[model samples]
Target: MNSRLPENELDELPREIIDFAKHIAALPDEFQDDMETAYNRVVDSVRRRRRILGLVQEALAQLRLDIKYLMFDLEMTRRERDELREQLGD
Candidate 1:
């Protein structure tokens, strides 16, 4: 799909962070510690984001399942109603 979401989906960290990580190792020695700190922050943020996203995905999946089951039951009820009416010649 032509979407921005499926690209990194370990819960959607900003592209800039990934870019920074890719280049952090190339920074001068004096800046490496700061870069390391920033990279660690990005990792933590990504982890939290993934947890939240996982919960949301699970909830949505459950809602879809429930909707499907309810629809199936409603259809069955309608069929039963129709059969009973036919038997009663109504």
Candidate 2:
């Protein structure tokens, strides 16, 4: 049987996964069923893990930006408080 994956699906998959799938496909017909099932499970797990990792990376970036904004606001507030104290003393 032809073992090549579709072009669109190949793009996101890592080389190792592709190679593993090709190896599985090379197995004898008697083992194809079990091997293909296991391969599908592995691919699904990898995709899920990748998606979670991407979400975490995105959240981390947003958190960093939020921290920068908060720092700026805190500095401004402190400066305003100092100015108010000086004016009162005068």
Candidate 3:
């Protein structure tokens, strides 16, 4: 018989406090539609921002790779042109 009941001590709370608690308890039901709408808006905003960041990151990486390739190609082209010019004695 060492069990304990889950009764709360808030039973002795003042009327104002109890009323406040009741109001808080009813908040979910009272603001149901507004809460749902706000949650969806927040979730959708996060998804959109994440997608935008992903796209930006991908674009930047590709641009960096492109710049690297372009620089390598430019250096190779210049070397080849110089060799040809020297070989042709021009």
Q: Rank the candidates by TM-score, best first.
A: 2, 3, 1
Model 2: clashing residue pairs?
Answer: none
lDDT of 1 at 84: 97
Tell me how far the alpha carbon of residue 41 in candidate 2 is from the true structure, in angstroms, after superposition: 0.7
Please, what are the lDDT tens digits per residue for candidate 2 over residues 22-83? 88778998998898888888878988998999999999999999999999999999999999
* Candidate lDDT values, in order: 0.75, 0.85, 0.62
Model 2 lowest lDDT segment of ten: 1-10
The better candidate by TM-score, 2 or 3, is 2
TM-score of 3: 0.64
All predictions: root-mean-square deviation over Cα? Answer: 7.5, 1.7, 13.6
Clashes of each: 0, 0, 0
List, residue by residue over 22-90, the lDDT tens digit for candidate 1: 577677878878978877777788879879999999999999999999999999999999999999995
Candidate number of the best lDDT: 2
In model 1, what lDDT does residue 82 have?
96
The C-alpha TM-scores of every prediction are 0.58, 0.90, 0.64
lDDT (tens digit, per residue) of candidate 3 on 3-64: 12123534433355445444444566767556555644554565577679899999999999
The CA lDDT at 11 in model 2 is 75
Model 2's alpha-carbon lDDT is 0.85
